[model samples]
Target: MRKILIITGNYGEGHKQAANALYKVIQLRQLNYEPIIIDFMEVTHPLLNPISHYIFINGIKMFPSIYGFFYRKTRAANSMSEILNKINNLGVSRLLKTIKEVEPSVIVSTFPLAAGAVSRLKEHGYIDVPTVTVITDHTYHSSWIHDNTDRYIISSEYVKEDLQSLGVPKEKIAVTGIPIRPEFCHNLSVDPLRTKHGINPSIPVVLIMGGGVGIIGDGSTTIRALENLPKKVQIIVVCGYNDKLKKQLSRELSNSKHEVILLGHVDYIHELMAISDMLITKPGGLTTSEAVASELPMLLFKPLPGQEQDNAKLLTDLGVAFQAKNTKEMIEVLSFSLFTPEILNKMRGNAKKIHRKWAAFEALDVIDEVQNATSSHGTPMEMNS
Candidate 1:
């Protein structure tokens, strides 16, 4: 069997979710491949692991504005290549040693850091495996489009254009959309899901989420806005791992006439999406993709800086969603649209039109091509940009 290594990290759920989707597609196809998914921080350097985790979490917490500023600046800077090169030199030796032991025939990286590490290894002749990067966000960051990568599976054509503007070869970019779990691909009947959730079919259902961390800016205010909406709408708020927020919401919404359900870290978001009339969320790549898969339109709440902001713009531009920067605007938008069945149906249609459900299969096909070429040569595949 051929060995394919998938590298991801826990910086956010998008990378891990994308990697899992590709893994499922490969398994379902029975492609004669052994896929191993590794979180690079777990295997490469133990001492640096915690530091990296802290930097991701605390950086967002303490200096989100500064982080966002630098993130956007890096995307437009000509010196980004030099900066990546320096970071690559510092980390590539440890990563190369680890890859040498695994001896993967092909590599798929979901995180830019891992992609950069593998690119450096290939550049230095430490590994010859063909490396494909699946960009986990709608926005194209310079870190994601490395010189040594063979192909990039991006979320949209906008991202492809962004890469081309940065001088990446057009052939090297594929707009496969973001890969999502196979369960999300199934066509679920909304009536049954609504029945299961005990939501009234007559009432519009709103599914609210704040990615994996469950903390959005002004979440309390958002909840307050929901309370003031038409009482006929039922609300399901997923506070992932944010127990305090869940409790606060539970307490505040205790006697509300609307059927408000508060959840903490659910494994069945697809079911929720199926039953929802619209999703109120931050436009994380995975969350938006999942919403599209379920044919649910989005009303973007407070989007975080950097990639999410770009994601929001892409969705809004596509006419599949609207953005609300404050509680008053969110309520105004929801109030006017929640009861408009025709408008809601059109948004759902737009979502289905934009969703690429076969993205996982397309990604798997690329992997198979790489494996076949490598096996024919009796050597690890050499990547060409």
Candidate 2:
């Protein structure tokens, strides 16, 4: 089997999730391809990886405005952003070593820095394998644009245009939607899942996720706001590997009037999404894509400044999502929407309209095509533009 090296980072879960989705689709389809995922930072900067990871996670939580400022300032291809991308290409030597050891037929990057590093290596003629960069967010950043990248897999045509405006050739872009888990492609029976999870099928099920890092902009505050709703709803919160938050929520919501189920790092988000009448979560690319795939309308809560804000705006414009600016707006939106079935149904219908349920398969097709074309040429794919 030809190896497909999937390079990702853990700064946020969307990159890793996108990588895992590609890996799963390859395995599920029984393709004659071996998918290997590596945390580029972990492998390249082993000692500093943990420290950097902590700062990235906490930095967003502690100082979101600062993070947002940099994120916004670096969106365009300016000299400062160029320097930062080059600086971000710190692990190029280590990445080259990894490529030598893995001998992959193609390199797929879900993280922007990883894509930049691979593009740098390919530009210098260090490696010839085809490179596919999957943009995990609805927005485009200069870091994700690399001259030597063979293909750009993006979530939508809007992003394709964004890249085109940034000078990336149109032929090098593929609008495959953001690849999501294969399980989300199929429609699961909601009633069974609700019963299995000890939830009432009759009541509205609101699924809340804080993304991978469990930073949901004050989970306790959000829950209290939800509890204030006059309607009775079943709330399911997926803490996502945050033990401290889970334990704290457990204590806080123990005496809640409504049934609230708390979970930590569940592998069954598809199931939860299946049974959910609506999702109250941060608008990360992967989670929102999964929610869209599940045909679940979303009440996006306090999206961070950057890709998330872009995602929230896109979803809202698409009519599949509503944003809650703060605790008061969240309460008002949930109360108004939950009590009215037509509102939620309209959003759900809108979600179904844009859902790319087969995005993973589409991405796999791109991977297969790139590998086959390169193999037929008997050379590493080079950027003609």
Candidate 3:
């Protein structure tokens, strides 16, 4: 059986989640193709990935400004990014060995570092496999563009132009929405979900996602703010893996006015999303894509300084979401926009224009087209590969 190797990393769940979502699509689309997901850093240096994951999660929390500085510094074509990429290439030898062992018919990268490594392998004639990069974020970054990459599956049209400005051929880029879980892509009924979840139809539902690691913030300020709202509302807090946060919210909200549902990490996020009227999140690419797919309006809580900020800006610009500068502003935005059904409906409609329900399947289509072209031409695939 032919195999498709998907490379990802554990810096955050977004890369790994994107890889898993595509793996699901590959499974459904190709009966003969076996999809495998590997943590690239584990393959390169087994001991390093855990340390790296710890540093990444804590870095944002401990020293956000410094982390933000590097994010901006490496966002465009710059010497700093060049130096980092050069440093990263030290692992390419191990990466090439791993690739050879897998012997995948097609390879897709959900992490930029892995993409760079694979590009080096192809450049050195170590492998001739077709390589595609699925960019998990909506923003443009210089590191993802490479001379040898066959195709780019991006989420935004402007990102496609950004790639073109960096000299990538237009045909090499396709503006397919970021891949999400197959469950979110399925058609869902909000009223039925609300009833099943025991959500009151008359009360507006607000969902606060603490992200995969449940680090949105201490629930004190947000909880207090939401409790003070005069309107009757229901708040659903998904604290992901932060057991402490979940317990704190449950204790603090026990006597709260609003109907509160506190959930720990769950596989049924799609179900929670279907029942809610609005999402309060950090605007991670995967979360935002899921929100759009569910037709849920977004209220982006205080976004971090890098890609989260960019993702929030894109959503606000498209009118699907609004960004709040702080807790005060977030409450105010909710008071004004959340109460108005007209504005909420309009935002949902805007989200519809940008949301591609078949993004994973679209990615599969691109891979198939690339393989067919390679078979017919017997050469390195051209644009649109």
Candidate 4:
């Protein structure tokens, strides 16, 4: 079996989520491809990986504005990103060593740092595997740009145009949306999912997510706001991988006026989305794409200032999502549209209009073409049609 190396990191779960989605696609398609997903940080700096991840998680969680500030400052500064890229590329030697060991026929990067290291490998003439980067955010960043990258799988056509403006050849970029779990691509009836989860099938459902690490906090006020609406709604909050938040939310919402189901670290987000009328959450790329695939309208909470802000703008622009900058605005938006079937219908329609459910399969097709055209001597491959 040919191996496809997927290099990712744990900065946020978005990169890892993208990697897992592509891996699942390879598995289900049974395409004679072995998808090897590796945490680049673990391979490059094992001892420091966990510590660094802790710092990042806490830093962003405690002070998102600070994180967003840096994200904005460096987002478009390609020339100014050189030092940062060089520091990331310092792990190129270790990464290249892993490449030799894995002997992958193709290399795909879901993390920008991993992409940097792999691109450095190709530029230094150390490796030539078909290299692809699945940009995990809605916005383009200089960290994702690198020479020697064969193809870039991006979120949307607008992002493609932006990359083109940055001088990346049109042929070098492909708009496959963002790869999401294959389960999210399936069509399932909401009534059945509601029954399975023991939720009332007749009532309109609201699903809330805080990204993978549960960035949504207690969300007590959001629930109170929802309850204030005249319409009766059932709310399910998925507190991903955040046990403390889950416990706190559960205790706090034990007597919530609106029916509330607070959960922790669930693998079945597809089912949740299938039943939800509107998803109130932070707009991470993977989650938003999954929501789109499920044709669920969104109520994005105050997004952090980086790619999330970008994601919110794009979704709101497409009319699939509504944004709330704070508690008051969140309640107001829900109150305005929550009881209106016509408005909700419009949101769902807009979601379907931009839903790219087959992004993983499309990306796989490109990767297959790249691999088939590649030379045995590890040289660049002309894309085979």
Best by TM-score: 2
RMSD of each: 3.2, 2.9, 3.8, 3.9
Superior candidate under lDDT, 1 versus 2:
2
Candidate 1 lDDT tens digits, 3-29: 789999888888998998999888898
Better of 2 and 3 by TM-score: 2
What is each predicted model's overall lDDT from 0 to 1? 0.82, 0.88, 0.83, 0.84
Provide the global lDDT of candidate 2 against the true structure.
0.88
- Whichever of 1 and 3 has more TM-score, that candidate is 3
Best by the lDDT measure? 2
Give the TM-scores of the predictions, in the order they appear.
Answer: 0.93, 0.96, 0.94, 0.94
Stronger candidate by TM-score (2 vs 4): 2
- Candidate 4: tens digits of C-alpha lDDT, residues 1-385: 8999999988888999999999999998999899999999999887888898999988876898998888877887555577788677655666777888888998999999998888877876788788889998777988898888899999999999999998899998989989999887779977777789988876778888887888764455555566666677788988888787778777877777788888888899998998888889889899999999998889999888788899899999999999988877877888778767899999988888889999999888888877777855374332211
Give the per-residue lDDT of model 2 (tens digit) for 1-385. Answer: 7999999999999999999999999999998899999999987788899999999999898898998999899898788898897677675677788787888988999999899888888887778889899999888998898889999999998898889998888989999999999999999987778779998877888889998868898777777677787878899999998899899889989888788999999889999999888899999999999999998989899988998999999999999999998988988888888878899889889988889999989998998888887863224333322
Off by over 4 Å in 2: 376-385
Error of 4 at 278 (Å): 0.7
Ranking by lDDT: 2, 4, 3, 1
> Worst lDDT window (10 residues) for model 3?
376-385
